[model samples]
Target: MSNVTSNSPSASNAVKPLDQGEEAVVRALHRVIHALPRAMDAELLREQGLPLVEYLTLMNLSETPGRRLRMNELAATCGMSLSGMTRVVQKLEAQGFVQRIRCEQDGRGWNAVLTDSGLARLEQAWPTNLAATRKYFLDHLAGLDLEKLAAAMRKIAT
Candidate 1:
């Protein structure tokens, strides 16, 4: 009664030769993971007036020896260009959150230091940020799944 051909395993299917279900699953996983950082960044920016990139830079400096890191090193750690990092540092400096100083070992190089204000801001944001991460990401995955995902990501990243 129907014109459509029945191409079960008995007959050769004319459609796609291979199933793309795995690719679809991979893409969905990628999207969910990618959306997380963007959402967290938006929340922090809206509530604290600190962009994620700026916060990451400040946090990195805060954890470093003397709460200072060379400008280039900070840029690399934050995955930003030197000029982009300079602009962010300028904004942080304006807000009294950070300061740029000459590197003690190399006068030609500059360092970005996280100020008390910067540390305080990070402190204020950290709990909520971490909670959001736990609620959205960690709480959903089993320990084994987390471990597997981490291993898979590390393999891909390398």
Candidate 2:
């Protein structure tokens, strides 16, 4: 599509610029990626007294077997660095919502266990999380094929 010879390696591997419609979609996607989390965080903090990261950490922990996961696994699940998850778990531990204990399977590593209080707190916040998710995200996806969209998104994420 250019003056450069198509046989060249650079030509074959070259990236193309977005057209107008493509550019609009990409920009909107970028905006939603950045804005959705902040909006949801604001709503949860106002209504549930929980920040999105903390809520996510708690929620993820609550879903795991025995309500526990290795610290690194929890970090990965919450899209955080290990150190970041350590801080969150520390805060939750201080509030009597989570407990950090040595991983029995491997003596060197640690696990983050959701305390009974943590489950109770998550239950209290579940409605707010659901409402915020629908308001800030799902409400706009009116008649779209959600299953297909989710599959596409999962593919893109990988």
Candidate 3:
């Protein structure tokens, strides 16, 4: 989804390679994109028994007005497939951390509702998540212009 385009001088139109600086940035960004989540996930799982995806799902639901979101909406918000979100919700439900009910506006759709237990669990894991985020990601940005970095990231995301 990046706006990057192939720049080929040859008739065959093969894509040109990134310059050294661009390649370095791309590789580092890609590694951080993956490694950060795995590091945080491992920490959370070890310390709090909650996977990063489940925490994100619960956190997203908690932020909604009624602490609930339609399954598809939650999936989008969490950047997960519908089936993946369903499985995470099922696990959370089995743990008594969430409840699934028919959506009021459309009974055919299900909503994931964060329960009291879920909130407690999130709160319990919040510190660990925060610590891991700081350790694996934030601390590395010590003197950088965060606003600019955030803007760049937003641009890439869009």
User: Candidate 3 residues 1-158, lDDT tens each?
Assistant: 23356455662476566787888888898898999999999999999989999999999999999999999999999999999999999999999999999988968999999999999999999999999989999999999999999999999989
lDDT, residue 144, model 1: 58
Reference-based lDDT, each prediction: 0.83, 0.93, 0.93
Instruction: For each candidate, give its TM-score against the true structure.
Output: 0.77, 0.90, 0.89
TM-score for predicted model 2 compared with the true structure:
0.90
Q: Please, what are the lDDT tens digits per residue for candidate 2 over residues 1-158?
A: 22345686876876676677878878899999999999999999999999999899889999999999999999999999999999999999999999999999979999999999999999999999999999999999999999999998999999
Could you tell me how far off, in angstroms, the CA of residue 36 lies in candidate 1 after the best superposition?
A: 2.0
RMSD of each: 7.6, 3.5, 3.7
| Candidate that beats the other on lDDT, 1 or 3, i.e. the better one | 3
Candidate 1 per-residue lDDT, tens place, 6-114, comes to: 6577546555432377567667778987898787788777777767888788789889999999999999999899999999999999989899999889699999999
Pairs in clash, predicted candidate 2: none
Better structure of 2 and 3 per TM-score: 2
Q: 132 in model 1: Cα distance from truth in Å?
A: 2.2
TM-score of candidate 3 to 2 decimals:
0.89
